[model samples]
Every structure is written in C-alpha cells, then in structure tokens.
Target: MAPVPKTMSGILIEEVGGPEVLQWKTDLPVPELKDGEILVKNEFIGINYIDTYLRTGLYKAPLPLITGREAAGYVVASSSPDFKEGDRVTYLADHSYAEFTAVPDVSAVIVPDDFSTEQAAAALLQGLTALTLIREAAGIKQQLGISQGPFVLVHAAAGGTGLLLVQILAVNGAKVIGTASTPEKLALTKENGAAWVINSKEEDVTARVKEITSGNGVDVIFDGVGKATFDANFDIIARKGTVISFGNASGAVGPVDLFKLTPKNAKLVRPTLFNYITTKEERRAFTEELFELISSGKVKLRIHDVYPLKDVARAHQDLEGRKTTGKLLLKV
Candidate 1:
C-alpha cells in the first residue's frame, strides 16, 4: 500500500444553507487514527438524505464539518488488529465526504473479496436502514398475531431504501403497497415487489390506500416523506399497527399528538440505523443477512449516478430536487 497522505481532498461545510455551502478543499488534513481506529482511503462515498440534512442545517453539527455518514474503501493505516493495510472495508462514520476517514474499529466492516467496493458503498447505509426497519423498528417477524404477514406501505418506494423495504417485505410474505409520484417510479416499485402502487402526486394517497385495503387501512407504514405524510399515516393505519417514520425528505414532522395513535391502538417509531446495531455482534448479524440477500439476488442495487467529487454540489441539488432515484455515489 502507498504511504498514507498528510492531507486529502474532500467537501467541507463551513456554513449551513444549501448545496452551495459544500466547499471542496484539496488541503484538508487527513484524519489521524486514535486507539481502535482504522484509517480508510475512501474510494466511494454514499450520498444519503442525512448528508443533505447536515448540509442544510436541518440536522445540526458544528461548523467547518466534513459531513458524510458512510464510505467504502481500503485501509491504509490502523490502530486496531481487526483491520490491516489494504483490507477493503465499508463503514458508518462521520466525515466520510473525504478521500480518507478515521473509522472506529467497531463501526467498520471488512468487505468480502467478492463484493465490490461500489456495491458495498451503495448498499451499506440504506440497505441496513431497510433491514433494521423491518426486523427491529417494526419487528415484523416477531408479530405472531399477524399470521399472513402484515400489509406494508413504503413511501418513495422506487428510491434506494424504499426498494429494499419492498423486496424484503414481499420476500417475507407481506402484501406491500408502495407510493411514488411518477409513472416510472410507480412501475419500478411494482417491478420490485409492491402488490399495489399509488401515485402520491396525482391521487389522494389516503383514499387510494383505503380503497386498496378494502377500507381496513394498512397494517404498517414506512413513511420517509415526514411532515407531508405524517398525519395521513394515522388515517390509514389499522388497529394495533405500526408507523415507522425514518426520514424527512419533505420536511421534519411537527409535534405529534399521542392521542392520534389512541383511536387505532397504533404504534409510532422514530428510529435511527445506528441505534439498531450498537454492538459488534448486532452489526455482524444484520450485515450478514443483508449481504446474503444481495448475493442471492433478492436485494438488487440501483446506482442512480456516480458523481465526481468536484460535482457534489450538483449531486445534492439533484437529490434535493428529487430528480434522481436509487443511490447516489461519489467517486473519490
């Protein structure tokens, strides 16, 4: 392996506003490894809505921050025995919008030889989000009362995480209802595993959902559209159902009235992926399952575009505009 560099190139956010604030710098200091840390020379970085959240100040972080949550690369230096030079890896960590990142040993997972770095980068964060949502946030598999698999509603069903949710839910025998705005997105949602698709742009989502469910409402809703779709969840959720609100693509949900869930005996969950995999054992188990799904062709990935590091502003613009579908990546 080549010697680790003293400085690296990456996007730095000095002020929170818009994509224009993602300033690219060639002389940013390379992160130094602390105990149990691995220094990764990033090859590909995953672009997530959370990155935009941080960039726009919707999610707060200190100024002059290097903002990104995940990246796939090869190790260049390590302070832990778990990783060695040239070991390919993908990890969840801060400051991933860079050429190199200092990742905690517990957060980094070694990439199997057969899994390309691109696949690892594209699948790690969003893939895990889907898996954890079904298995942890909603605990679909443990709901023994729902014998025939619960009816699931996945908003943005053609997007990166939504597609995974549809596939996994269908594979587990759940009847899935996916919502997307465009015809192309709706068709893609159907192709992925949705039993029904609703065009949120043209149709009344609540009424369509009611019609599809024969007026019983859905048993579970995976709503990432936040404020725009939050209230409607209560209107469509069945008795004893779960509503998992995991993202804020439109805007953050306002204060909730716990009373809203009372009428249906419903449950609301606001979960983050990190909380679901807090230990090495938990991380390994979830990651192994996700990888198996990918290898078995049950969970196929769709890369919307791989932007050059210098074009990150355009990448963010496209994402915020909802102009692209599937995962966006940055080649470092």
Candidate 2:
C-alpha cells in the first residue's frame, strides 16, 4: 500500500451556529486505522438533513467535529481480516467530511460489482432508514391485516428517504398520500406511486386526507416534519394507526399531551436508527435487501447535486434552505 498522508482537508464544526460555521481546513490529520478498523479513501459523501441539525445546534456534537454521516469509497488500508486493501465499500460513520476516514470494520459493507460507489453512499443511510420505516416502524401490513398493500401517509415525500419510502410502499402494493410544498415535488411523488399528494403550504393536510380517504383516515403516517405536521397527524390518522416520528426537519416537536392520542385511538412511535441497525447481522440484512432492490431495478436513486468537498458550506446552505431535492452529495 502507498504511504498514508499526514494531513487532509475536511469541513469542521468549530462551534455550531449555521452553515457559516463549517470551516474547511487542510491541516486536519488523517485518522489512524486501529485494530478491526479500515481506512477509506472517500469518493462520495452524502449530505443528510441530520447533519444540518448538528450544525445548527438542534442536535449537539463534540466541538471541532467532522460533520458527515455516510460515504462510499475504496479501502486504502485495513487491520481486519474481513476487509482488504482496494475493496470498494460504503459505511455510516462519523467524521466522513474528508478525503479519507477510518471506521470499524463492522460498520462497512462491500460494494458489489453491480453497484457503483456513488450508489452505495447514497443508499446506505437513507435506504436502510426507508426499509425499516416501511417494513418495521409503520407495520402497515400487520396493522391493516394484509400483506400486499396498506394505506400510508408520508410527510416531505420528495426527500431522499421519503422518495425511497414511497417507492418501497408502491412496490409492495401500498396506497400512499404524500405531502410536499411545491408542484414539482408533488409531481415526483405521483410518479413514484403516491395516489394523492398534499401541498402542505396551499391546502389543509387534515382536510385533504379526509377527502381522499372518505373519512376513514389512513392506516399509518411516516412523519419526519415534526412541529408543522404533528397536529395534522392526529387529525388524519385512523383508529389504531401508528405515527412514526422519525425526524424534525421543520422544527422540533414540542410538548405533547398523551391524552390527545386517546381520542383518535392511535399511537406515536419514534424509532431511532441506531436501535434498529445495532448489530452487524441487522446491518448486513438491511444492506442485502437494499442492494437487491436497486440491482434488480425495483428501486432508483436521484442525485440532486454533487458539490465539491471544498464547497461544503454552500451545500449546507442549500440543504438547509430546502432549495435542493432528492439526494445531495459532496464529491470527495
């Protein structure tokens, strides 16, 4: 193997404030690969909304932290037998806003020849989250007493995970109601199998859902837009329905009175990503399922914009402003 570099450039969160806080520096040292760890030369890094939370102090992280959740690349060095030099892989790891990163061997998956490096990076974090959201969190099939299809409502339906959720639901025969703010996004949702799309800005979510479902309400709601959509969930959810509160893109959801759900006969669930894919076995299963879906053409990925690593601040700016669509990536 070639000699490892002494320094690398990355976007650092010196002190959280806004996109302006992401300081790009060339003096950051390349991390050392320890036992059971692999060093990756990143080719593609994904920008998720959660990264914005950390940057804006909505979610706290240690000072001077590198701010990327996932990336794909070739293994440059390894200390574990499970991976070798030059193996193409992708992982959900901390400190990925750089040219190279070190992650525990257990955290990465080998990229199959059929899968490109960009595809792997784009799919890991969001793809698995989508899989669990549909098959586990919502449990629509079990709740509706059917395997083929169930009624579902998804907020921010044009998002990376939202788009995948809609695709997965459509493939499994589920009828979905997606909410987006604009006509373009709503059109994308419709193309992806959303039977009805709600322009949350222009229309009342509850009223539209009632008109579409004919007053019975939806079987489940996968909500990531916290405060803006939380109240509407209770208004539209069916009796015994499940609300998966997975994210807070609009704003953090405030205090809730549990009694509110009692009237609707519904329940709220917040499924954490770490809890779902904790073990290597679980991660492998998710990767296998996700990869199979993509390889077989059952799923597709949309690359919104590929920003250069040096332009991370603008990437953060655009992502935070909600000016971009689908998956936003940083070319490492």
Candidate 3:
C-alpha cells in the first residue's frame, strides 16, 4: 500500500446550532480502516437536508462529528476483497464530510463506466430514496400495476428526490400532482411529468388536488417537507392511500395521532432510508434499479451548486433556506 496520510481537512460540528456551527479543520486524522472497510479518497460529496438536521441537532449525532452520508471516490486502500486500489465507487457511509473516508465495502457501489464521480455522488442516495418510495411505499411492484394509472402527490416537487419521483411515476403511468413554491420549481416539476403543479404559497394544495382528482383524492402522497405540508398531505390523501414522510426539511413531523388514519384507514409510514438497505443484497437491488434508470435516461439529476469541501457551511445554509432546486455537491 502507498503511505497512508495521517491527517486530512474536513468539517467538524463541535456544537449543534445553525450553519454557523460548522467548523473547518485541517489537522483531523484520516479515519483508520477497520476490517471489511475500504479507504476512499473522495472527489465529490453530496449535500443533503439530512446533514442539516444532523448539524443543527434536530437529529442526534455524536458531538464533535464529521457529518455527511454520501460521496463518490476512488479506493486508495482496502482490507476487503470486494474493492481494489483505483476502483471508482460511490460510498454511503457516516462521516463522509472528509476528503478521505474509511467505509464498509458492502456499503459502496461501483460507479458505472459512463458516470463521473460527481454524478454518482449526486444521484445514489437520492435515487435510492426515490426508488424505495415508489417500489415499497407506493406498492407498485410490477409494470402492470403502475399501468393502472395511480394518482400520486409529491411535495417539494422540484427537489432532488422529488424530480426523480415525478419522472419515475410518470414513466410508470402514474398521474402526478406536484407542489412547489416558485414558478421555476413548478415549471420543472411540470416538465418532468406532473399532471398538475400547485403553488403551495399561492394556492391550497388539498383544493387543487381535489379539483384534479375529481374529489377521489390521490392514491399516494410523498411528503419530505414534513410539518409544513403534513396537514395538507393528509387532507388530500385518498382512502387507503399510502403516505410516506421521509424527511423534515421544514420541521420534524411530530407524533401522529392514529385517529388521523381512522376515517380513510390510510397508511402512514415514516421511514429512514439508511435502515432499509443494510445488507449487500438490499443495497444491490436499489442501486441496480437506480442505475438502470440513469443509464436508460429515464431519470436525471441537476447539480444545483458545487462548493469546495471547506464551504460546507454555506451549502447547509442554502439547503435550509430552500435556495436550491436539484442536488447540491461539495468538491473534495
């Protein structure tokens, strides 16, 4: 093995506050590789709203932690048989804010020959999240099932995962109703496949969805905006509809009253993406389907912004401020 570096530059959150809490440091040691782990020299890191949750203590993390969950890079050293030096891969791991990360080989996906590291970093985690929503949450397992033309509602329609959801649902024959705040976002959502785009700021989502669905209500509702959109989401949901609240960008959706599921008997599932793909096989299924969509051009991602790794705090600020539309990245 080539000489391992003893230190690297990365952001560390010593205290949980606002974006200002993020601290940059150069003397932090490159994490030691453990059994079954491969060390990657990261070239691109994904910036997610979840990272802001971790940074601001909305979600608990070990204090004084490197905070990030996705990146793409080349393997530098490995103790595992699955990877070798110079293999291009996308890594889904904790503490991915650094220039170098020691990650489990099972948690990494080999980047396709056609993709750049930045592309992999931008799509892997968000795409997997979108896949799980449609496949498991929406209960559209087979092609024929989707051809039935289910009604689907996607909140934050122009978001990184929302755009993919719209395209996937549209490609699978679902009638999509997407909600966004700005004209640009609404237009993007409409172009991607939304049958209707509701300006949540200027219009009532439940009313517009009811008008479009003929009062039957949508069969599937995907809400990543959490508290800000929960009441509207539940209001517009159909009988026995499947609803998933996977993120808390606006604020955490507090405890649910089971009574809320009463009249309609709808299903509400609050899930964490990382927990769903713990095994290698589970990971493979998500990546395989996601890569298939990307390779065939059924889905695409836009790079909203690229900041140097040290500019991570600014990335978080933009994310929390809702100043971005597509995927955000940190160039390492």
Ranking by lDDT: 1, 3, 2
The whole-model C-alpha lDDT of candidate 3 against the native structure comes to: 0.88
TM-score of each: 0.97, 0.96, 0.97
Over the stretch 52-102, how does candidate 3's per-residue lDDT look in tens digits? 889888889888999999999999999999899989999789899997999
Candidate 1 per-residue lDDT, tens place, 1-332, comes to 67878999999999999899999999999988899999999999999999999998999999999999999999999999999998999999999999999999999998977789999999999999999999998787733332388888999998889988998888877889999989999999999989999999999999999998899999999998898899999999999999999999999999999999999999999999999999999999999999999999978898999999879999999988888778999999
Q: Give lDDT: candidate 2, residue 52.
A: 88
Q: Poorest 10 consecutive residues of model 2 by lDDT?
A: 139-148
Against the true structure, candidate 2 reaches a TM-score of: 0.96
**Which segments of model 1 are wrong by more than 4 Å?**
142-147
1-332: candidate 2 lDDT, tens digit per residue: 78789999888888989788888889899999899999999999999988989888899888989988899999999999999999999999998999999999988989999888988888889888889888778764323422346678989999888999988888777888999989999999888878889998899889989898889888889998898889878888998888889999889999988987997789899897768889999888878988998899888988888999989989888876767768989998
**Clashing pairs in model 1?**
none
Candidate order (TM-score): 1, 3, 2
For this target, which candidate reaches the highest lDDT against the unseen true structure? 1
Off by over 4 Å in 3: 142-147
